[model samples]
Target: MLQSSVTPHPERDRLMTRTRRIASRLRDLRSAAGTLPDAVVLLDHSQHVRWFNHAAEELLGLKRPRDRGRLMSDLLRHTELAPWWIDGAREPLNDVTAPGHPNRHVTATLLPFGSRQRLLLARDTSHLTRLEQIRRDFVANVSHELRTPLTVIHGYLELLDPEDVPELAPVLDEMRAQSKRMGQIVEDLLTLSRLETQDHVADEHVQMVPLLASLRKEAEALSQGRHTVTLDVVAPIDLLGSPKDLHSAFSNLVSNAVRYTPTGGRIAIRWAPSESDGATFSVQDSGFGIPAAHIARLTERFYRVSSSRSRDSGGTGLGLSIVKHVLNLHQARLAIESEPGKGSTFACVFGPDRLLRGTQAAEAAAAGVPY
Candidate 1:
């Protein structure tokens, strides 16, 4: 390999030496808050613009090197952003002009260079806007999802005053189950948010016996008289991360299997040393498997492969999202394999180091998960 040597310039050296002090003085004089948004621009005495930053290229979708030395008019040629270079107005413009329609919003403003030239500072707000839209859609989806269940529960209650609806007891019970599922979803959402906002790292070691036991118990209860849940291993499994995080992750996977699998179907939880430097906990079930096209998006928040079935099965739709995030916190990862009409397998692959060493082995063996 050949190495190239860089030579230093005296004049450039002096300029670099004084650059910081100059920038500091300029920022102190300006009232701009926080860090100025990063952007790129070009300008000359007349209407020419040279080049700018990578952010500028992305936001404006223009090639800098190719468009350099081009006229500002040719660059923003047909857009309202072109007139933003004219002298006199320093105020920001919030315009989105089209053939006849225009958008309204203000976020960034343009500024002059030295004496005559100027540059436009446009911040990329598209991501933020998309996030807002997702938030809106999620709320609407959740509300729409819960509406039917809520209505059914309400209708059942109204039609059968507990004492009067002795004949409709079964329907009332079903209504109550749906209402409770919705409630569980709401609660899980809160838990997900709280976990994400926390700074919990996967390095936090947690005693796994009780947590896993409780999770298995919860799964069994949810399974009720459906599948016979079985634990493939014993635990006191000292998970090398937050007990809460691991439990939540495993619980979601197991819960989903139990929820979707038909009655009398077998649900198995297996834990064992998996490969070098890792342990694996897998949840297997004889449930309705996911279609090939939908497997990739199964973890997406609120993304349900089977809308009507998701409703019938009473899923809050945030279960996998929670599992995904919780595993991220534990430094573990999820691997899903499924065949439509068969069943699915969700494996929580934890790093071997995250497993308890020495006497902790006994703990893990004793605390094995209940499949």
Candidate 2:
């Protein structure tokens, strides 16, 4: 064997020092993240557990080395979680009981990270869930309690003849209108409470043609020859869901279009196939358009773009909230598009699974119009 003497490169020492500094900083970051209260778990592309924090062990019963590299579904053992974790469902699962700890509830959220990696975060939500339950119970009870008195008051007012007291006729009319508005608010609250209890809609096919016709009539009646309300149902296909729920949602949108639009504005209701191969029912109005800031919170109960305008228009403010719940039950979503001072469009997008196309729809597809 021949031996050769070689000198070390000048940059070798500098390179080693830089590499050590980077590694030290990474270790410090990892340690800091491990101490967070929320349980954090990192999964590889195959959904095998890659790394987890101390909080994960305490909250999820995951043990180092034993649970490492195990599939999340195998460790969590929740039937519904796999779809949510793999299919990219945006909503977080709430009140998920931890393994061997029924009392400890958590809300879990999954986010896709670098490449195909996933980050699973879970936070204890037992206290928040309890608070939500209490709020729901209180709202349900109060709404139910107010219904009887409101009905009685409305009935008594109806019995009193306006012609009998001509001098007080205007006062009686105003009172009657205000009472009806209050009754509507209470009824809407009850509807929201009922919807909250349901996970999904019953599988009953709803006729779309008749529903659209009825809604158009309602919009015209509410408009009273003010706005020009038009219905352009490109695909008149039946939907597999509760007719009552769909009607309420559709009617609320029509009514809102009429209520918000100016006297000479145009309101167009359209039902057409979306570019994504789904069906969309949209209500577009050339009204005093909503501000961008208010669009996000439109579905919140009693939320209004302008409180004064909402009150003046006799809006219960629960209309959009009810629409949201109805769409959720039907496995649909409400998309709002608006531009201030121009117009607004509220579209309910339903997955293709909910559509039931008939021969007429095929003809409509060929002809490119539905009468």
Candidate 3:
């Protein structure tokens, strides 16, 4: 009697088949995730751990059911991680010590997915970090070693009397120029190395009025009546940074303008206010503008748009790299706008935290400063 109505319903059979297929796919996905080298953690909107793979257990020390509702920040308590997490994890946090294994280094990246859910991926970058450190140390040592020899060669070349060697005057001049350029390159490398090694810079009241004026003077001297160099101070605000370091960064921008600009070209240097009470120091030049493709790599060490042109302009190609390091220390950024045959503008954008407007603004307003 019970087997009298053993008929299969087509709709129910189809639904059962679809459900089995979905379950199989989910199991396969879990298997794939468990085998990944990167730690994969699923987080909710509150940044609480919802689920994780086997790699997460090994790398992030996350235990299933035990760390299920625990805060991600609590699991990974890093100073730099807090801000990055709070800021929506827009950028990756690199070379951070792994929470589970202190000796290991990891790069953490968080991406948002369905309905405020986030996927946290932490990859081991310990080897890459060590390689970068080794490269930096090698560069510093080589630059230091080359400095003395370069100085000696430059000194002897300076002492050479062109009048004493009438027949070899041109050769002597060329030798002296080459030596001087080499010395400059060594000095730039040393500066870049030093900047790279430092995590922070001394914060002091940087008088922008005087600093901008001085930079303008340096630019004019470099220009030597060749280019029309001008300084415009639209924002009468000082900065909170190491004066010497700031000067170096700003001077590099200005000098690069003079070097790249053709004779009779216009170069305008401006200190202007930006959004949120921030400031920007920009050097606009009517020179050979950089191509769009080469713009991104401009800050890389020894990166050049035109090697021969850079050499002819007496550039070491490390200037932008140095500027990048300096800006990173100051929590600033460099913005480049260029068009071939039109012009180029290099702007160092500083945040509001680096601006010292309290005293400087009062003084400028009281004195009715006209820049």
Candidate 4:
């Protein structure tokens, strides 16, 4: 060969230095992984274990040589975890307990990286879960204890005669109203507790016409000639759900519309099929609408957009939360649309899976027919 290597490349030294720095950084990262608190695992697109940190070995019970290249499902065998792992869930799984460590609760999250690699992180949530359980228990116990006493007070207040005590008539009337409001709140709390504790609802074909008629009557009574209430039934499809739960959800929305809308305001209740073959029962109102800020927390228990206004309107403030729970049991959702001064529309949109098409009489006789 000819003598062509007389001069070295000018950038050869700089390239070598950069490569050495990169290698050093990678080594440092590997060392840091050994001391992390949360379990960390790296997986390929096929869900095969690429590597795991020291915390993973301790928390997840994953061993280096034995678990490497194995499928993640092969190690964690919880039935509830199978769906999230296989479906490549975008949302993080909360309150998930690994099969081996049933008592140790962990929240698992996945982060995608480097074109086919994924990083799985498991954070211990045992303490937080315990606190949540404590809160629920406290609320349930307090609500149950207050129910009998509240009923007694309400009954006694009802028995109080304004004629017998004419001097304190206005005060007694006010006391009765306040006691009645308290009773309503206590009842709603108990209902909420029962719903949270109960599992799935016993399904049946609920007659829509009768339910709607009942709701209309309630709205009229609540309105007391102050609001113009109208019912528009475009589709006569019965729902496959618990009649009691459905009635509660619908009536809550209707009564809220009646309560909030000003005198002579129009409240339209409509039932129709949605674009997705599902059905929608919506209560549109011309009322003092909700602010954008309050809309997000409208379904939260005891949350009031305007505290004074809600109290004046005799609202228990648990109506939307109850509606939310009922719709959740039926695999449906509430859609609330509003503007500050214009009006509000509360729509309970049921998925196609929950709707039963045909005559109400046929559906009721059939019990529950799939559409």
Off by over 4 Å in 1: 1-126, 129-161, 165-175, 202-204, 234-237, 360-371
Q: For model 3, how does the per-residue alpha-carbon lDDT over 1-371 read when each residue is reduced to its tens digit? A: 35656887999999999999999999999999889999999999888998899888877778888999999887766644567777767898888777757778888999987899999998988889889899989989998999999889889988989999899899999999899888889899889889989989876668789989899899989989999988899967888788888999999999999999899999999999987778999999999898899999999988999999998999998999989999999999999999998889999999998887867656644674432
Identify the candidate with maximal TM-score.
Answer: 3
TM-score of each: 0.55, 0.85, 0.91, 0.87
Lowest-lDDT window of 10 residues in candidate 4? 362-371
Task: Give model 3's clash tally.
Answer: 0
Clashing pairs in 4: none
lDDT of all predictions: 0.70, 0.87, 0.88, 0.87
Which residue pairs show collisions in model 3? none
Model 4 TM-score? 0.87
Local accuracy of candidate 1 as per-residue lDDT tens digits, 1-371: 97769876999989987998899886774424223454456567775766566655655555747877887667665655656645434677543332112332224466778878787666655456557557756765676677677667666565666566688778777777766776677667666666655656645456555555676788889978777887766444556666666777888888889888999898888877676768788989888898889988988888998889888877889999888888877767889999988999999888866788657656555666321
lDDT of 3: 0.88
lDDT of 2 at 233: 83
Cα lDDT tens digits, model 2, 235-337, are 6676878888899999999999888888999999999998667899999999989889989999998998999999999999999999999998888999999
Residue-wise C-alpha lDDT for candidate 4, range 305-336, written one tens digit per residue: 99999999999999999999999899899999
Which pairs clash in model 2?
none
Count of clashes, each model: 16, 0, 0, 0
